[model samples]
Target: MKIRDKILSGILLVLIGVLLGMILMFFRQGTFSFDLAEVKVTEVNRSESPIWTDDELEKIDDRFVFKTIAKTVTPSVVYIETLINARDRREMSPGEEEDGGNFWDRYLPRTRTVGSGVIITADGYILTNNHVIESAVRDGINVTLDDKRTFDARVVGRDPSTDLAVLKIDAENLQNAVIGNSDRLEVGEWVLAIGNPFRLRSTVTAGIVSALSREVQIIDDLRRIESFIQTDAAINRGNSGGALVNTSGELIGINTAIATQTGSYQGYGFAVPSNLALKIARDIIEFGEVKRGLLGVTIESVTASTARRAGLNEISGVLIIDTVEDGAAAKAGVQSSDIILKVNGVAVSESNQLQEKVAMFRPDDQVTLTIWRDREELETDVVLEEMQPIVQETQTIPENNFDEEQLGPEPEMWEEIPGDENSGIEQQSFRELGFSIRALATPEDPDRFNLYLHRVQRGSEAWNRGLREGGEITEINGNRVHTLDEVEKEITDSLKNHRSLTFKIRTGQGTDGYYQLF
Candidate 1:
């Protein structure tokens, strides 16, 4: 029996040795028919996606390959040339219009500014920075393609909220930058900054997306709309309105601003999120204006300090400060003290987050605002409001109270004339601060104020609203503006919206003081 057991054990050892030998043969002899030789035939059919080109693939192996990538992506990028007629002082006295200090400078272009833009559409809709058309006072804006050809550009519309402007050049078959999804962008993702930095066309710089939704100062407006994709790319003056593209040359952002005290290229740069810029540009092209939704709530970021003060268990989310009276917030029951946790289930951390969310809506569209109130979370429906037309109030001579101390030159022919009897009516309180007006005494009670209709200049905000010579603003608004100071304060306070001043007025004595919301 012992001999029989030994024989079986020996057979088992022999079987194990044979299995080991088979395994080694399988690995050494192109096992499973998937060796490198077979892999090549499979790849030839698909081009191995992305790295299909030898140069692109070789760079990936090198770990320091941005040149080949940039060269391939640079052509689709565009260079924007802006013919800015920036209204600036040239050390000239009262009556001298020194147009760029030369004969051609006067009649020809005064300020020729060249920047960059990404041609988003093939048919000539160029995406650029609002500051690229910076002045909003351009005599004409021109576009020069990657090709040397130049085309006259038209400002379709500008969204100062995003610092994006869409220009239309009458050219077809134009190369548009590839568009990318910003939602897919992550911190430390590779991105390329391509533009005419300091007027150098088609210059490309490489960097990574250092951050997202970083609030930086792009302008001086009280509203801090600096929710930008931060990158370490070398962005400079002429780079404004250029393209911040991905490795594939897809447009992801419109490079708009930089953080340099010397006004030159700094390590950091900002870009208008292309997703937002495109949304606004499309609207401007189709409807002549950006239709961003209004939530009517003033929001602030919940910092650690604010989070503790506000009793927030977590130190993130947006705090609702002031809900405009009778506006969307008021209607939505969003009170001043409530903290906003999210919008439509998306967490909001700052005003820019809320603003960006709201901007996504169209007028009349409803949105759900998630808020924490009294230690309880609640969701409220808010109806988005249309952005009322806001025309900038320009500087005008105040007929009523001219600030003689602050006066510049008044069209030289104008010296102090003997006070005309009619001048008493022009001496209203608000006249000297860049607005024109007249005053009248109420006939019913010689002491009471009356509607004084006068012809305003063509470019005045009142004129833009179609104010006529015979129109009488009867009231100063909800308040009485018989004095010019009252009128000025009310207008200045509500400069952001379309609050018209009403005058209790009629064409004749039967009328009363009327108002006009300028």
Candidate 2:
């Protein structure tokens, strides 16, 4: 009986051990049964395998790229503050003497303006917009570096045509910005604008290059060079002199202006291309001023109508309206009505682009201009000359006492004609052209008839073509037109013949001038 009981116990112990082993195996594998069909195994071909797949390598974070650029570029941008003398306007009692106003006003008040700039040289050469330091008072220009070190800055030179200026700070070991090739920048490429906007230092804004070779006409100077890089960056008044850099943290442009109605960012901002800005900066440093080269020709963009008139196969290139007498273009045999297609192998489609391209060179630099005339493409080598400063004399006209009605009965009869239809021109309204002229006696010389332009419409073709109010027309189509009848007849004949009407006129300053009415 004892032996049988011991055998039962041994059997029970063995069964319990076997059950524990099965439970442990089930927990380890997380299943009681294994199915080969439920498993997935990828096969590798070592001969065709790459160390890393293209998709895996391309999954770089954009945040890392932007952060790297910011880290590299922000150190080169600086803040500029200018102090200008302000004019005082204090009202005085009526009985007070004029001396009272003059004495106090002589003590000019100081006004502070803030801006941004980029360091281009390690030795402390900085580039900024001219307007930032235009009228700054003596000993008032200040520059602050990234580390908050402030120093007094001196103006090296300024070029108003390009709205650029160079400044120098008395500092060494500065981080200078790396300039990139602006010509290689394309639309849709990412860019960053760094500046002190609204007095906020180290402000950064990101955008894409919206366009290239844009002529915004923000600069009021007649010789303004505006091949701007248009961006959607949020640039404000204080950002005018800041740096517009690429993803590589290389400077490509200088933020200059914004297209806004509220004096703030409204989606459109413009920058001066780095190539042109650097050229002007270098010229200023070397010559103490901008050494601009001139082609010496008045040019206009080719429109469809202009293309038809000039007999061009395509509506492109800049149309040379007139060549300056004895100038580089005239000496190069460039004639009026010729279309300039290229400058130094680069195609130019606008008058401003041609102007900018030529302005990039110094005086006496040789340039090859591709011109289209009589349906033939001709290459002409032109040695540029230094552009002479245009000296314009201001004239103030006195209010006239003579009435239009008193001088009018004959003028009224002339006005009865259907001026628009008789000329057989389309969309050519005399008013839309932006000028109104009246046949009047030349007060200085009554014997000579003069057509005085009393009203010049703003933004009109005439206004844009540089015609000003108070100018006098002396001839039409190269013929002396002393009377209104002769002037009308000449315009009618030219329009009927599909010829552009040329005018020989006198400016408000009594200087002789030539203009074309198309």
Q: Whose lDDT is greatest here?
A: 2
TM-score of model 1 vs. true structure: 0.61
Give the distance in Å from residue 33's predicted Cα in candidate 1 to where it truly belongs: 62
Question: Which parts of model 1 are misplaced by more than 4 Å?
Answer: 1-72, 89-109, 136-139, 220-224, 391-518
Q: How high is the lDDT of residue 421 in model 2?
A: 31
Residue lDDT tens for model 2, 384-475: 99877664311222223455334422221112233343332111125434555665555565544567665556555565556665567787
In terms of lDDT, model 1 sits at: 0.67
- Model 1: lDDT of residue 16: 99
* C-alpha lDDT (0 to 100) for residue 59 of candidate 1: 57
Cα deviation at 491, candidate 2, in Å, is 15
Name the regions of candidate 2 deviating beyond 4 angstroms.
Answer: 1-64, 88-103, 392-435, 439-451, 455-512, 515-518
